[model samples]
Target: MLFGSDPGQAEFDEFVRSRAQALSRTAYLLTGDAHLAEDLLQQALLSAAKAWHRIEGHPEPYVRRILYTQNISWWRRRRFAETPLDAHEATTAAPETGDRDLRLSLEQALAQLTLKQRTILVLRYFEDLTEAQTADMLGLHVGTVKSTGRKALDRLRALAPHLEELIND
Candidate 1:
């Protein structure tokens, strides 16, 4: 069990069952790739399980810290260099609806963002964390959080201008 006795194991399992999907979605936001997100979530959960004894009372923060910090570490070590299909190959794939196309465009735009900008956007908007909370989580000043969030949003807008219609809708 986490940071405690046998009772803590039950609590930890319950927490995982209830929050796994939500946490996975957060991980997906941090990492654009669904496969990587699953791996990231699994690793974070294993790390949390190991420290259950110490973080028994509050495991969420510890797990989230692992998710964020380790994601950065992994990206740094691996250059995020994914190969792209040529236009001919891409267009030859199964046709998608407008909604799917829009989602893909947004995802591509998100991928284009710098790590800092992408992280800030995901932490602030996708995770619905306050600037203060994001600042604390990322170990940045609140001012830095605000500025980065603003800049990230601006860049996202510039990258996917067509999303404005969907946003309004």
Candidate 2:
């Protein structure tokens, strides 16, 4: 049956379950807050549910678009008021000591970036999206994506100088 058919709810639920963790990671990277990430994912899923009939075949891209767009909208609403995680709070669960420190520093650095820059970094690195794919998802040109990625990287470098050492290591 087509996505718009009577059995659409099951398909939609399956899709959400399969993609929830990826979406939550992306949302967490975007918002830098676990609670906000859950809220963002909930909002994106709701929007996706509304458009399920039209997007069933290409669910990943459609859902990613919804996630990115909803994240941007949330940023525009100026509702992000949480304080950034402190150094202690930025710790990760990695077993490798070096990796844990790097992850914490990166998280701290990411939190300092503007919403646009943070989103670009998440799309580029966390989601493993190409510049073109990120541009399409973000409704920006490829050049803009490239430039934003550069700027975001630069800011990250400034915020966490140790990242360069980590990168080199």
Assess every candidate by TM-score: 0.72, 0.76
Per-residue lDDT of model 2, residues 47-166, tens digit only = 888878777476877777777898888776774663334445543443335776678777777887778878988888878889998898888899998987898787666556657764
Clashing pairs in 2: none
Model 1 global lDDT (CA atoms, 0 to 1): 0.75
Q: Model 2 reaches what TM-score against the true structure?
A: 0.76
Give all candidates' CA lDDT scores. Answer: 0.75, 0.77
